[model samples]
Target: MFSFYNGFKKFAFAMDPETAHHQSINLLKRFPLVLSEVFRNENLGGRYGVQVGNLHWDFPIGLAAGLDKNAEAIDFFTRINFGAVEVGTVTPLAQEGNPRPRLFRYVEEESLRNMMGFNNEGAEAVRTNIIDSNRNGKVLGVNLGKNKLTPQENAKDDYHTLYGTFAPLADYLVINLSSPNTPGLRDLQQKDTLLELLSELDALRLAFPKPLYLKIAPDLSFEDIPDIVDVVKEKKLEGIIATNTTIMPERGAGGISGRLLTEKAALVRNKVLECVRETPEIQVIGVGGVSTFNELWDFWKAGGKAMQLYTSFIYKGPKVLDEIKHGIDSVMAQNDLKSVQEILDNINHISKP
Candidate 1:
């Protein structure tokens, strides 16, 4: 089956990156049920499930946002091994998003750079898509972001509206203030602004409580982490997702992801984990440059739980997930572990590759 995707990649890779992305999305849109059969591991999930706040992921690894920005393929993603599927950096209104040639690939680095500014089918349309799609009982999250046109001062309004729209629909909801593509988005990560922005949602959260997370960037200074952590704790949100795509200007504009992001993202994740160490209620979902089981192992070692993947899925296809699952199976077998929670409970006792 990997050989099938390998051959298909040759054709997909020949075209522009964004076009290839659309082509793949369109293909999944057509044959999701069939694709689900080919890719899903029904019982594997029960063996390896991990708790993330109120939600339980079938496995630790999930499909990150941006891959399915519009919820177009929720049926396929949730059907596969992905423990969870997060769609959208959805806005209040439909956006065309920062012109073409915005998505670029670093083939050798197995990385990507995208200046795609929350280009998604507005909340109403996407909500309709989610209402129509089958989540297969797997966790489904919607990553919310302000529309490109929404002013910084009114940023809370966008989030408030998105929260109102998705809370009942999604298993969990993420407040994305991390993507570097959007202008002035990161500014909201500042402690005062973050508090103010999240405070606006307190009323809605009380009315309809949902597990919420603030996704932060890898580019943020280490000193800035505690403040963000404080904001999450103060807001009584579920946890934080660290970190989002990084900006490497030398590589050009937009955020850098995959291999290019590993070291930097890990640093931020560790910092976040360390900050939240005293507060077990807060979980840090490691993202960025998460390729194989090694990264997941490292994250577990640092007291982190589940993480998400984007670029690695592009470079290695579904086989990457299978390999990671195989790795978990082997480690658990060797250590006489029963479940993923058991491994995490005795994480330091387990052997690593």
Candidate 2:
């Protein structure tokens, strides 16, 4: 499998990154059944189940948002052994995103930079597509974003609209306000702005309840976390996803993800975990920079309920998902633990001192 992925990477990387991504998505959409069986982990069930909110994940590793922006290929990915598949950053209206050359690869660094600007087939189309597939038993999520043309002041409307449409269909919903690609999007993460947005959205959510998580940027200061946590507590939101990507202006435009984000992502995740230490109901979905077993363990140690991957999936291939699950199993066995919750329990106990 590794050799096959190596060859596949060589071929895929030869083309532009976005083109390669679209090609891969096309292939999955084309041969969903065949590839699903080829990549499916037979032992995933029972061996590594983790519960997040009301959902039971086959494993803790999930595909992050932005990969299947339109939810066009959920059938293919959900069968590929991911415990969950988050689709979108989808806006209310279809968008073309930024112009060409929006994706760049830092080959030697195993990092990616994108100014994609939340391109998708719009909320209605994405919701309709996923509904058509019945999600194939996938633990699905929708990452909602405001349209680029929409002013920041009215951003909550887009989020509310998406939640109303997809909340009933998805297992969970993510409020994506941190993508560096979208201008003024991250501003939504500011304490005052975020508080107002989430408070209003939380009210509407009461009518059609679902687990809603906020995805924040890695560039936020440690001081910025508690205020966000305050809102999570006030709104009674499910959790926070730390993070989106780091803003690296020196590298030119766009946010840099993957290896470059490992440290910062962990830092922000730990910070959020610390702030929410007393409120266990508010969890943290540790994302960014998770490519290896040790990093996964560290994220668990940081009190993350789950983890998501994107750049690693791009650079390493589908096998990493199974690798993470098996690695977690090994850790559990060595520690005399029975489940992901047990591992978290031990980590919490140790952190107390």
Candidate 3:
């Protein structure tokens, strides 16, 4: 099956990237149940199960946000080998996103640059899709982003609305104030604004308490990282997704993901983990540029409890999840470690200052 997809990938890449994405989603949407049953792996999860915050994931590798932006593939994805499948960057109101030529691929770098400005069918539609679908009892994370037209000051309101809408159905919720495509969105990452947003959301969570995680960017300076970590700790947050994507020139315009982000992501994940090591309440869900065993090891070495994948799924196909899980299991055995947690525990203990 992987061989077939690998070959199909060449054909898919020949077309416009967004068109290929829709064509792929259309296939899954057409035969979701059939695909679910075909790809179901009953024995794939137990050995790698983990409890981050209040949720127990079947494994550590998750399908990151942006792939299934509208929760269209939740049923299909959850049936596969991933520990979790995150859906959306769902907004309060749907928008067309940036423009036509938004998504691009650099085959040599195995990276993607997309300024897809949170295009989706909005929060209510996504929530309904999840409620109507067969979730397969797998962990489902909903990544929430504000509407593009919403003023920066009212941004927290958009998050409040999305949080209310998604929290009931989600295993966890992500406040995605980090996507570089949304104009002035990354400004939310500024210390005062970030704190205000976190504070507002934290207060709201008291009413419907669920694990809330923040997705940050890889391009942030080292000086700004500790403050981000501090906010998570102070808010009594559940986890932090180490990064979104990088905005760099060499990788061309837009947020760069995949191979280009590997090193920077590790550095960011390590810094966040190191800062919050003393606080077990905040688990680190490493993202960005992780598609291989060695990269997974770097994340674990950096004290990441779990990881997520986006662009890699585009380049490598669904088999990437199993490959990564097997790689983790193999590496654990090689080190005589019982599980990924053991490696994380060791990192936490050793890095304690």
Candidate 4:
């Protein structure tokens, strides 16, 4: 199956990246039941099921946002064994994302590059999809952002509106303030701006509570991490998704992905953990370049309570989940670690200051 899939991937690579993604998603959607059964039997559940506020996730390995912008294939993705599926960077209003050829493949680097500017069918449409996805038991997270034409100053209102509409349907909500594709989105990550946005979001969550996680960028400097930690603590946010794609690549304009981001992501995860050491209650979802069991283990070692994969799924195929879960279980057993949580605790004890 994997060989056939790889062949398909190779064939897809011959075409434009964006087109290939659409083709793949359409194909997956066509066989949702079969895919789901296969993934479930694989037992690719994460080391532990984690609870974030009101949401209980069966695993740490989740599908990140951008894969299903419109929430069109939740049934298909859930069937493939993700612990959770974060759909959309959906805005208050729907709009075309970016010009043609917005997505590219860097095959040599084993990476994908895209400036897919928050393209989606809008919050209302996505909300309906989420509400309709009740058949799938997998956890759902909605990643929210402002529309492209919306001014930066009005961003908060857009997010607020989305939260109001989608919060009821989502197990978790992600504040997507880091996508380079959206102009001025990263500006919201600035200290004062972040505080304001989070404060408003925190207020919203209080009125209508849901697990809220902030999705950050891997391009941020080590110094920027503490500011984010402070805001999370101050607002009493549920958790943090330690990275979105990075724009600081030496090569190009689009955000980089895959193996190249592994070490940097680990560093950021370590920094975030360090910043929140005294407050171990705050969860961190590590993402960025997690392609192997070892890299995932390294993320856990670095204090990530949960993790996510994107480019890896693109490169390694669906079986990657089973491979990672089985490999980690073997390592944990060999090391006399009784559970994933126990292993994480041990790693924290050794690594924490």
Q: State every prediction's TM-score relative to the real structure.
A: 0.98, 0.95, 0.93, 0.92
lDDT of 2 by residue, 154-261 (tens): 988888888889988888999998999888998889989998888778667989999999999999888888998998888888899989989899998998999999
When summed lDDT is taken over every stretch of 10 residues in candidate 1, the lowest stretch is 36-45
Instruction: Report the number of the highest-lDDT candidate.
Output: 1
As for model 2, its CA RMSD to the true structure in angstroms is 2.4
List residue ranges in candidate 1 displaced over 4 A.
Answer: 40-45
Full ranking by TM-score: 1, 2, 3, 4
lDDT, residue 212, candidate 3: 91
Candidate 1 local lDDT, 1-353, one digit each (tens) = 67877987899999999999999999998899987676555457388899998789989999999999999999898877898999998998999899878999999999999999888889999999999998888899999999888889999999999999999999889999999988999999999999999999989999999999999999999999998999899999999998899999998899999999999999999999999999999878899999989999999999998999999999988888898998898888889888899999998777854
Indicate the TM-score of model 1. 0.98
Sorted by lDDT (best first), the order is 1, 2, 3, 4
What TM-score should be assigned to candidate 2? Answer: 0.95
Whose TM-score is greatest here?
1
Score candidate 3 by lDDT: 0.83
Question: What are the Cα lDDT values of the candidates?
Answer: 0.91, 0.85, 0.83, 0.79
Candidate 2 Cα misplacement greater than 4 A, ranges = 348-353
**Where is model 3 more than 4 Å wrong at Cα?**
36-42, 332-353
